[model samples]
Target: MSNNPIPIVDFAPFLDGSAKQQTADQLLGSFKSYGFLYLTNFGISNEEVQEMFDLSKRFFALPHESKMLAPYPEARTHHRGYSFPGREKLPDAGDVAEMPLPSVKETFDIGREDDDSMLNVWPPDHILPGFKELCLAFYWKCHEVEKNILRALALGFGLEEEWLVRHHRMPDNNLRLQHYPSIPLESVLTKKVARISNHTDYASLTVLFQDNVGGLEAEDPNEPGRYLAVSPIPNSVVVNAADFLRRWSNDVIRSPMHGVRAPQDMVTEDGMLPDRYSIPYFCAADFSTVVDTIPGTWSADYPKKYEPMSVGKYMLKRLADGY
Candidate 1:
């Protein structure tokens, strides 16, 4: 809240050949600095964003039994469907032995329905008419935005503009709808539980649309132990580099740690909490795509820091560790 910590970038220039390079440079600077950026004029409209949020609210409002029709374990195989609150805990950077605090959030996950291996789970059409279609429409919109960003990122890294797009043809991207329910004041003040634990995303990039009730925070790039509030910006989407990108870039780009806290002003006079909603599109390359350090990202002094791994294997390992 102090001073919008993340830099804002206009994405419209990326479409024009004359201004494309400048836009790519700005994106590169933001990636190297905070690994987060607020993007506006990216083609997805404000009305579309609101529609997605409304649909998400409706989905979560369904009866618990109805929401659980697509439950975990079965849902875990394809990483789709509903996950109740308190089911996930993200451990800190070190000390895996230490138990992690359970996240105070419920999530519904969906992936590209076209992929047989990553088919999505949906409620009955009669239960929520047009829910699947609307959600998929939003998902593809976000994915389109993601593809354009990746092209700019490739330019940022001095690689072919199509370097990333070619490999990500059939990405294992996911659309996740997160709901952080309100909690009692006493529990919040004393327990210090966060809606989500501080953690880095496991994908190559993430495009997020969050409602006005802001609580997202990104770790300061220059100052450790300090964080910058990433409040929602009107007509913009928050995009961040993730672990895979950092690895692929040979650490030239960072995947900063981020978490969600309950908004202080969200508590009512009676201490009731407000429900917070966010939709994040997690983008990654194809499962069989082998990810190694990209060209021109490594030097003799700064050698390749990670071993090459298939995208699918690495993603599965990260998912298993967290879920």
Candidate 2:
């Protein structure tokens, strides 16, 4: 067994079909124990990942006015555009209607091309040539990898491999690019705000790719209030279970709470923390699909812990609560 609390799983075995069952068994254990893992060999090349990062840096470097051309909607439900730092609020100290922390990060959220419920916001070709085309292509590529993981999860649950994949057929997911710029170390030390406050995701699952400047941490399962740093491994993606999956599994797989904090050792001589960047793909289910405990996940020993709920309703409520 690895000394690291979170295991690293190679996805090649699952895709090749040679050791699919063995791969699924390891995945099942990770989800049940840590609710998170580092996944490698799931497709997508390092060059492609770096290109996305380069695009993000260029986009964020633009003048504030120019970047704001594609504005975030006033309605939280319509989440497809650029959000300036501190624009989003998330619960950190408590679970309440009003979240207490204003994250010190800027974000650009992209949804599926065919999502008719809300229009996508993007910079014109003149501003960034081929930006939309590249992002869209990358979005679908990530989805292909997502489907494979869903299939693995289904197989682990003793259901058809396509079971979870079918539920997420609709294009209702989010691809977010985040930039946490350098900030004074005093602000972090005083607990005035965070790069991203401690909170669990609202989606079914999240696949995260982060740069070398690492500060992401998962709440230690063995210690309630403490956290364990999740260092960045080159070319690895961090995968974690989220709220909707927790509900669907009837608490069989809990969503791990996580957040990012500035590393003290990396503090600059000028008392500033270095900038950090990350890309997270939030995978969700079809809006109208009703989420209930998966088959074989509950019984007399563990009855269904949640009521049936539609993904749309659940997502809206969670988004509203965060704001």
Q: In terms of TM-score, which candidate is strongest?
A: 2
lDDT of 1: 0.85
Tens digit of lDDT per residue, candidate 1, span 216-262? Answer: 98999889778788998889999999998888888988899988765
| Runs of candidate 1 exceeding 4 Å displacement | 75-77, 92-98
lDDT of 2 by residue, 149-255 (tens): 99999989989999999899986889988999999989976768778888899888999999998899888888888887888988889999998998899888869
TM-score of 1: 0.95
Q: Report the Cα lDDT for residue 93, model 1.
A: 44
Note the Cα lDDT for every prediction shown: 0.85, 0.87
Q: For residue 321, what is the lDDT in candidate 1?
A: 75
For candidate 1, the per-residue lDDT at 162 reads 89
Best by lDDT: 2
Judge candidate 2 against the unseen true structure and give its global Cα lDDT, from 0 to 1.
Answer: 0.87
